[model samples]
Target chain A: MQFLLAFVIGGIICAIGQLFIDLTRSSVTPAHVLVGYVTAGAILSALGLYQPLVNIAGAGATIPLSGFGHSLAQGAIKAVQTRGLLGAFAGGAEATAAGIVAAVVFGYAAAVLFNPRS
Target chain B: MTQSQGQGNLQQQKMQQELQQEYKQLVKNVKPRPPVLKNTILAFLVGGAICLIGQLILWFLKKEGLGDKEAAAATAAIMIFLGALLTGLGIYDVIGKYGGAGSMVPITGFANSIVAPAMEFKREGFVFGVGARLFTVAGPVLVYGFLVSTVVGLIYYLIR
Candidate 1:
């Protein structure tokens, strides 16, 4: 159920990009700005505004930037008292390393295998 | 050194300038980019799939020797390194080409942002140019991510 939630949540987020592509005249270059969009969404989620979206979407809303933000936020809270100010910088990376590594290895492999046409 | 010869040389110089101007004008006259639905969807799926794989890795690591906390951090570092590497090798761009933002929305994209600019400016000298601009785009994300996360932690504590 969790995996299913993650897949659907993640897939719907991806689908938004599809909608953007079909509806607008934006090029691939502008579309690359997705990192920014996700970050914004995640930050908003952290602030509590995006919670409803996450609840409704399940993993979909939370998985992308919001999930990421939640991870970092938790990390920071964990590390701040022990590490002080420096914890702010290191916490997120420390917390989310597993997910990060997985994405890179598999993403790179996919790049190699599918050789997705640019 | 005759008037006729001088006139011919002048004519050639004038023609050269006109051609340069024409080329510049042509470049400026490009049409606005049209939307590309297919590629964008491809990017999202590809990018999201990357994240999904990251999740699996973390799960595997937790199942192994490491705890979930340690495993997750290890995953981030490895992925970030790979993303930085691919961005340098010009491979990440190719994925971005096909998957669109879908390919970029993951942590790897953030990794690319930090590494790509640094690589580009490596020739411009390191400290001021390359090193400084290296993490420029990523700097904001990191800073903001941290700040937001702190707030989130507070909220989580309060609620749970």
Candidate 2:
């Protein structure tokens, strides 16, 4: 049941992205959808809306790029409470540091080791 | 003779415009429309499948006694690794072709965005090519995600 909910919720979010691509005739690329989702997710998280979704959907809510935004907002909000204004500048990146660093390290390795095909 | 020449030029311009318009109509009629419904279904299924995998990882981590936050972070790292590995293997592109946003919306897609361009630009050397182009697709995501989250944090601070 948890997995099913996650699948449905996550799938819906991605389907929305697909709709944006098709309706825009590819003018709105995948990168645009990703950026937009993150921004929207942060705004929604700030508004105290995304958490409930996360509670219900678990990884389904948190796995999408929007969930990444949610974590950033959640981190900043947590930081502000504990560390004051200084946390605002650092918390967002700190929370996501693991993912970003992993991507960079693994991405660099992949680039060095593999060749791209046409 | 000058007046006739001006009239002839006007006639020529009109004929050219008419030909262009006809060609546009023909091209429009021949171009096939995208399969919107099909793509949406594939995106939904593929995106959902990826998230299900994430959820399973999260569950496994929980069973191993990790807290929620730690597990989520580890899940993301693992997913990113999988994405990069698949991209290196040239399989992620196949998934992207079929899954579209479904494949691209997950963290794996983020990895693909970084790795695909990095691999493509390898001939230009690491610093100028791989390093520089690595974030071409994902750079905006990080820039805006942090910027907006900071603003949201500021607002929260002021409000409370």
Residues forming the 10-long window of minimal summed lDDT in candidate 2 chain B? B27-36
**Residue pair clashes in candidate 2:** none
The reply for model 2, stretches above 4 Å from the true place, is B1-30
DockQ of candidate 2 compared with the true complex: 0.80
- Give a tens-digit lDDT track for model 1, residues B32-125: 4435656655755776576666666665777788974576567666656667667766788887677665655666666666665566655566
- TM accuracy, model 1: 0.60
The candidate that achieves the highest TM-score relative to the unseen native structure: 2
Write the residue-wise lDDT of candidate 2 on A1-114 in tens digits: 999999999898888888888878547876798899899999999989999989988888888999999999999999999999998988899999999999899999998899
Task: Give each prediction's DockQ, rounded to 2 decimals.
Answer: 0.21, 0.80
TM-score of each: 0.60, 0.90
Docking class of 2: high
In model 1, state the lDDT of residue B74: 70
- Candidate 1 lDDT tens digits, A1-118: 5445555566666656556555654354432444445456656655666666545544444445545666666565566656766665566667765665454444433333332222
Alpha-carbon deviation at A92 in model 2, angstroms: 0.5
Best by DockQ: 2
